[model samples]
Target chain A: MSEHLPQAVVALDVGGTAVKSLVVDRDGVLHRASTPTRASDGPEQSFAVVLQAVEAALAAVPPTHTAVGVGLAVPGTVDENRGVCVHSENLGWTDLPVRDLVAARTGLPVGFGHDVRAGGLAEWRLGAGRGAEDLAYLSVGTGIAAALVLGGRPVVAGGYVGEVGHGGTTDGDPCACGGRGCPETFASAAAIGRRYTRLTGTPVDGARGVLDRTLQGDRTAELVWAEAVDGLGVLVSDIVRVTGASRVVVGGGLVHAGDALLDPLREHVRRRLTVHRLPEIVPAVLGGTAGAWGSVLLGWRAAGRGDAATVERYAELHRARVTS
Target chain B: MSEHLPQAVVALDVGGTAVKSLVVDRDGVLHRASTPTRASDGPEQSFAVVLQAVEAALAAVPPTHTAVGVGLAVPGTVDENRGVCVHSENLGWTDLPVRDLVAARTGLPVGFGHDVRAGGLAEWRLGAGRGAEDLAYLSVGTGIAAALVLGGRPVVAGGYVGEVGHGGTTDGDPCACGGRGCPETFASAAAIGRRYTRLTGTPVDGARGVLDRTLQGDRTAELVWAEAVDGLGVLVSDIVRVTGASRVVVGGGLVHAGDALLDPLREHVRRRLTVHRLPEIVPAVLGGTAGAWGSVLLGWRAAGRGDAATVERYAELHRARVTS
Candidate 1:
């Protein structure tokens, strides 16, 4: 752990409930920080809390600094080149240039990116898809969305690529995107917990609780899980047809169900596809730190200091390891 | 023409019925030489015939000697990097190393490319899509397929990007791609003629004949034409949903129907799309010679003499025009 201190970059992952902060540098080492988002207090107040967190993290930084860049991974539609969070329903943000605001406050050259896309970048570069060129990252948390990486580059699709949540379904269920029958309405982690609790007389508070009951043969949990996995399969199939991705990385709050959810999804996708090669569906390796690590990488790349900073940190890490 | 006698690329476009050959310099100036394909005689027989035609054209080149490459454009899934014709369903080719064969035979580097994608490249570089970045080239011919160009690079999704013909439909007749209710079942030129002939009992020969009858107020022809337009509209809508491409260039055989198809398609797409921005649908400027010209340009780029070739040809073309 002491060996990881020298080669660190700042990563800030903004979520509705909490803002996760971390320092992950060249060697893939991690030092984490968390603060309440209080999204109801809005972008300005929440942004202040984020700034305070960054200050605290910066205080721990060692002296041999080359340059600093922040990766602010936010939800919703982001105009990445402009560094603006266009719209996030959960954060209630609309046309906010969060990148400029953060940079002005922190005096750090910041790297702004979409949350799901950033998580995918982390997994692809440092985790499950380390060598895979074509992969999809599906995050089934409070809300559902995906980040598709094709030929080693994330498919941005004119800022509308991975809206798997809003890939309007043939089913009849209302989605918060103001659409009827969207994939997120059934496949999301929140949906899994809510749907199971509603179907059965006995309530399960969270996905983990539902998973425990499911292992004990709860009929409601089993049904709800099936529906969620079915939705996931459908969404995955659509992406497969379009992108021809060779690998899929599954993560988020619901992934705690593990092999129970993954095994069935793998079977369904394989059954549905007739023409294309069936992609390997695997669990994402970065776990919870994916977004934060991804943010720092994005920041580094954005600043055009990638090679220089990486080499410097690599040398520092080697020196530290030798000394210790 | 006399002053620039030696400055031309032998552009050979291999199709099902005929092989269209021409000498085109960097300027759009063309000298034509065409012959029957005789594809049923098989690849070796067709190759012998084509070799004679190419030799005849080269012999006609009067002394001024600047031909650097042979540009061959064929209807097929071309492995552009390897310069191989992987498979062309219409041409009955499989694993033909066309570029190497042509280079060895002609003593010049060969630039081979897929006909439709080459046509799209021509349109994008010098025709309707000259100024646009994210555009689509929809070639609605005997078969229906589209080439997607994003950021001036064609989206070849692992060699299967433009297979738009098999795009399944909601309620339609069966298709040849082993899929029930595909877009090509009703939207293709052949389909248009078939539907018109079946409905009216008029025994119209082809798309042109059907269009002529429709113009004469034949009820069944009009209905078939309308349905074809609607099918095109559905395909266009699907492209928008998946790609978010804002500019589309339409070409191929059916497009010769002109405003009869375009006006109706424009109206249908506008009426159907409630949320997303309606893309500007327009016609391609490069007519029959798009593929050949684009292939020549590709050859010029490959040889590292593109700029010099363009300048020399521009000067020669200007001189020719002045002398004429």
Candidate 2:
């Protein structure tokens, strides 16, 4: 019966290149808008772009619906409790009072957090990480990062908790990040394409193009793919051992490869583990909408509607809508 | 005033080879006892030996002091909430109702947990992990293992967490655990001695002997030590990335190598990390006594004397008394 209640939220997911804004309710996504984030223009300009995106989302709220609140997610180090963005190398922001700026401008409550963690929160609440007590969502995008949810709470650790891409592992090549053995050098979506092109002297589309070549029985493509799987195996093993993550939700662009990416990586981590519980390695079904969707959660909390029943109601509605 | 009270607890730290028992109060260690564990004789005999050790410890409690409770820490997978030993290959125990049996036998409230985690608790409370909110204590014993403490609480995860010894990483050789890339194959104290003896056809006095040979300009010792350092660097980098461990207390036998082990491992991890916060890599000051000392904390909890004030009093009394 309460499903008939008209309530909505405005949310913005601020990334390095783009800021995705969405208007959402329990029923589903109502409206969406996108804007370029001129991050290199530095904090003030980026701040202006974020505010513009928020305005666009606020405008998309249906007239019949009550605009509950707004949520904002941005890249790099963030302190959610204090509502301050500590640092963002991409956007050139430091100690930016993201929540205060948005709250002051909109005269409404604002929820703020790190983009990847926000994405992981969405998965934990409504998608692949459902029912997992300890879950890790690894986002293998243009830049690789991971997010951890332990005991059903995001392990924020001042937003530096999941930079797996920067760890100097053992087998991978030197990374542009100035690390000699980082897994991102071989496994991240951009790195997969970069390595394949460097090895074959041929430009491919992206990690997707390389996957296509592998299906066609390209030996070099298979080798490159194998290296990526191995790198993921090593990194995932570390995550499992230290965090006891019972479910690993593989998210981001490379997850588009589907079984081709997960199957071998799962097998590799399995063979490497001697006395550890095998976590279910599954694709994050929410795709690119996760961060924005998670912002919806943040919005409801800011609106004082963040009860378990409210979240569960959305879980029943959104999971059916998005996952399907 | 609390320091004048003569109250105590009996505690046991059961390892694969030996069972250490301690009778203690806030002031410091009062009584210590050790017994060989015939773990190969299976669960019944091992259980009998444990009971005998407990009896001995109870007897050692001074006549004037009241023994409040008992704490028992054991190896392998443990469910602390259930007080059950889930599995222990060394002791051939599975589904052993440890707390029930001990409590019924002694008529005392019993506290139970994993041994390595117990040691980590000791460190977090009174040793190198003193001020760290998120800490990892790596025990480089005959078999390498680690224990985690997050948010000032031990990450139990049904005792499957912190098996870094068994993770299939990228640098180390094949281990007896059937993993081709476990850090334990190289970085463990046992592994260090084994590798040194295998290369030079000379037996050493454990890992300590290999350190001595390295000081004497033995090239094989240096090579073996370098491999160990590299392996540890890779594992530690992953730990820092995944867990955001601000303090890593290196415990067990190899920590005796002091700066010889820590200096190179610290530098290696520093080179491997690019963007993460620099964690302090320090030796576990309590050394082999940590697990038994940690058992004291568990004992106090069982006795209804576990509180922040009680723990703080212990910290003030024990750190000064033990650390010196």
Candidate 3:
């Protein structure tokens, strides 16, 4: 609907561990630059460091780039439409004017979005969920979160769709969200490690060590793994009942366990949901780069370059970048 | 719009114990007729009886109708678009070709819909949910069922909604649906009477006797009542979680217990949901007549009569019926 503007946008994906930045042109080509998050320094200092990374990424861009716009994907709840980080417990943030702050520092238009939901959008459009209309992407990293895409539009569900953290667990497990019984308290990668440590008084690195111990015939590790699977089953059952998703893409840090996690979680859900059709649970194809790719996609859409007509423009730009 | 048609559509609402027939003119004036369902006689005998009732209601019309279209509402799971009764445990139906059978018999276009969902549509458009866009209506009669109206469209949720009967209870309870613990196994009006009969070793007529006994400080009755309230609370909490509804309209036989049932159930849901916004739980405005009124509204919409635009047409039709 508007004239095509050949511009490169700055994309930032802020996770608990690191901040990933990319200078992406109208094409989906990424000139990547990443740095340690250092979230302990709080929002002010970390934001300054993020600005430096963004500036460095933008400075690398060619002279053809004009009017820099930034797309940010941040972990935790976001008032996305307003470009504010409402509350990101992992980042020690409360009502931070992130987009405004970034804009003030970089003097660029910013688009803000929830990290998992933005990743889900990328998965739905170009990754695992490509050509699929109705889908739910469950990213099970430090915590379990979901993004439901229906009719190509995500059902905000009053912003409760991905708050799977507060969904009740079988037993009363403590959650940081103040809920005594939540799926996240039992099934998250953090929960797996916590449970294993609590059971055997052996502090493991994360879910990977817990799984390793279980496979090595550690009885306590086996019990913790079983409970984690059961917690996941409840979440999967509830999602199937409410969202009617035909396909679910599962991703995140915990998925590193791979078939060990997938096999049992799938079996448990199949056993519980006897009445309805079960959706296929598959690993995410986009992997670690999903959020950054999603941020770039968001920027492309924001720049009015997301539609049937623009696919050719995208292809041409992508080809030119590859040839160059 | 096209020129106003003088034709009247026949609306049949078939419940477990009753069959209600209405000759609703284009404006939705119901000339009502009814009879016992006699469902134990089986679908064949009962369907024949329904046809006769429809014919009689048609004969009672002041003016012989033009091209007739019939809208029939039935209890249980249905393929609404296909006009097939996929299954009705109450009606002893399985994969019944209801639309084709009725259409063949009546020689008219037939529209079939799930009774609860159709009733919810009626309520959302012309009853309790008249102005509200997003609403969830729970009907608790012989069983407990729910209907979600979102943006004026009743969500079927893969045809699993309105099956609140299967929602498991907090405490284990016997349910006829072959589940160990189900909401309807304790909270339904049928459950109240059954619980009373089991406790006293005497046949209590219905929910009213149990309510009366509870008022009289009968320990058995009080326990039963509390369990029912708790069961209902779990169902409502799950509904609130999935739909994010801020207002719930409850109807059916159990709701007649009034504040005794409503107050406690509301309090339980409020206490359970700490994180999500609590919805207002209120009695349905449609009362016992919701089904019949909803049938009329369904016929009205099916006949291309708009609620806001058909005030004069509705008045004229009402006057015509009154004089005739």
For all predicted structures, in order, the TM-scores are: 0.80, 0.94, 0.81
Clashes (N, CA, C under 3 Å) per candidate: 0, 0, 0
Judged by DockQ cut-offs, is candidate 1 incorrect, acceptable, medium or high?
Answer: incorrect
In candidate 2, what are the lDDT values of residues B1-324, reduced to their tens digit? Answer: 534558889999999999999998766678999999999888999999999999899999887677778999999988787899999887788999999999898888888988888999988987889988778898888877888876666777666788888866544577876776677777889999998888888989878988898899999999988888887887787788887778899998889999999999899888778878778999998878889988888888987887777678767776676657
Tens-digit lDDT track for model 3 on B127-192? 566665457788888888888764445665445554666633223664666554666667789988
Which candidate number maximizes lDDT? 2
Which docking category, incorrect, acceptable, medium or high, applies to candidate 2? medium
Root-mean-square deviation (CA) per prediction: 5.9, 2.9, 5.5
By TM-score, the candidates rank as: 2, 3, 1
Best by DockQ: 2
Each model's lDDT: 0.71, 0.85, 0.72
> What are the per-residue Cα lDDT tens digits for candidate 1 across B1-324?
553554666767777878777776666555677788888898787767667766765665436546666777777667676788777777778898888988888887777788887778777766666666667788888877777775446665544455566533324576665554565777888888887777767787788888898889987788888878887886675565455567889988888888988999888776545334468999876677677666766666655555755745544543464357
Candidate 1 Cα RMSD after full superposition onto the native fold (Å)? 5.9
**TM-score of chain A for candidate 2?**
0.94
How much does candidate 3 score in TM-score?
A: 0.81
Model 3 clashing residue pairs (backbone): none
The list of candidate 1 runs beyond 4 A from truth reads: A1-7, A62-67, A134-144, A167-174, A185-240, A244-283, A303-305, A308-324, B1-6, B46-62, B167-174, B195-234, B257-278, B307-324
